[model samples]
Target: MSTSASQQADLDPASFRAIADLAYRESGLTLVQEKSSMIQSRLRHRLRDLGLADFAAYCSLVQSDAGQGERRNLISALTTNVSHFFRESHHFDVLRAELDRHLPKLRAGGQLRIWSAGCSNGQEALSAAMTLLDHVPDVARLDLRILATDIDPEVVQFARKATYPERLVRGISPDMLKKYFDQTTEAGHEPSYIAKPVLTDVIRVNELNLLSPWPMRKRFDIIFCRNVVIYFDQRTQEKLWPSFLNALAPDGVLLLGHSERIAEPERYGFTCTGPTTYRPCHALKSTARPEKQKQSEG
Candidate 1:
């Protein structure tokens, strides 16, 4: 590819708007004008792979009836998947502290469901699995499971594979790493580690678009949707709050990204318990919004 031709592959204004609209309608991801360059950079490979010369041709193909499958490809290309094991440590700490109360119920065969919404490459879900294992080594045999879902099928597949480069496991503690991961090397391939069966055994990874209807019938006890909603505009975020609340069990916890706040917690029947952490108002036995406590970093 020549330099000039590559540079010209950038999406034109019309094409950019069409893509942005399609992305929002399909995935609830807000692609503002400023993201045009990012879209161009990310999807430029699609043009090359399809033997197309410019963004116009790429746009036409994606917008046509035959482009249905490419729509998923487009989402996988544009979505960000930056995640690491225990990226936010405090949430796990809180979960650890609270597990005592939940363990007995779980031990008694009560179901304990946790959802890692937008679980990119399985780190967050795996981290939760490790936490559970730390407190209850037999958690996998109990009625406890973590549902890890991402909009990108590629990332979901990566999560299901449960393998990671050595560097990605840096945040894991030495003791935990020894217990939960098995390091291995295949000739000619980079050294990597895979989560132990104990971890993978209790987690289910699947591709799910949050904008579409959820097929889950069971509510979650804890939800980790960090950094997932920042790509959505306020209106879109507002629309999601109710669905999240509905998905959460009574007294269930909701964890959001540091920058993502529930704009109107009371409007969504949520009470802020800690930074980026919320509980349903009904669960607290009060309709009034509680005072916002200082949030811990997670």
Candidate 2:
């Protein structure tokens, strides 16, 4: 075949629609018409990997029963994994407040659990671990655990590795960077840091699809489902609210990304405690609020 004949064209409209439909059905990801070009850009490698000529063939496989496993690959390719160490400092403040209220329980061998849903690359879960250790130096010996889950297995594996190159380590302060991570350098390569075992010990990295029923039996004390559901459409977002509401313990706090919010959260069993922060409607007004501090990057 000539070079021009062999070259793949842009994702055709039918192929985009088929892929979009599969993504929505399997993972609740919304792939709109306007984003077709971007979606194609992301999935082109899948075509190359399968030795396919175009998106159409790729789409065909993913929609079939035989493509069940490939559906996960499609979702992984489409899902966004952008994250930072202390992306929003206030959430850690909330963690500190919760630790204050819940530390006594932990000391008594009671449980305190935090869930970092969509924990792209481990920073969020690691940040929560840092906050916990800062509060109780021997927290790893206690009943506290951080459950970090993502739909993408690739990012889950990365989170498990708990290593970051310099670029990915941007949001961490030098003190925190030193305290939590150990720097490893190789010849002619940028220094990379990995989370010390103490930091990762309390963190349980798992592959979880938020759309699937949660396997965890224990309700969480704080749930950080941040910057995750923004890709989901309104109906999909609403569907997740009830699960989160049910997943939280009484007086439990739920924190969303600054860019995400639930309309009429009260109707969904949540009280607006702060911007994108919530408490169960049945909880006391002051459930997890320790003291208000002006937010700052740490």
lDDT of 2 by residue, 7-49 (tens): 4557998898888888888888899999987887788777777
Off by over 4 Å in 1: 1-8, 286-298
Q: What ranges in model 2 sit over 4 Å off?
A: 1-7, 186-189, 285-298
User: Scored by CA lDDT, what does every candidate get?
Assistant: 0.86, 0.86
Local accuracy of candidate 1 as per-residue lDDT tens digits, 1-298? 5545655686899999889989999998888888888889998878777778888887898899999999999999989999888877778866675566578888888988999999999999999999988877777888988999999999999999998888899999999999999998889878989999999988999999998999999999999999999989988899899999999988788989878899778889887877788889887774223324655433
TM-score of each: 0.93, 0.93
Instruction: Give lDDT for model 1.
Output: 0.86
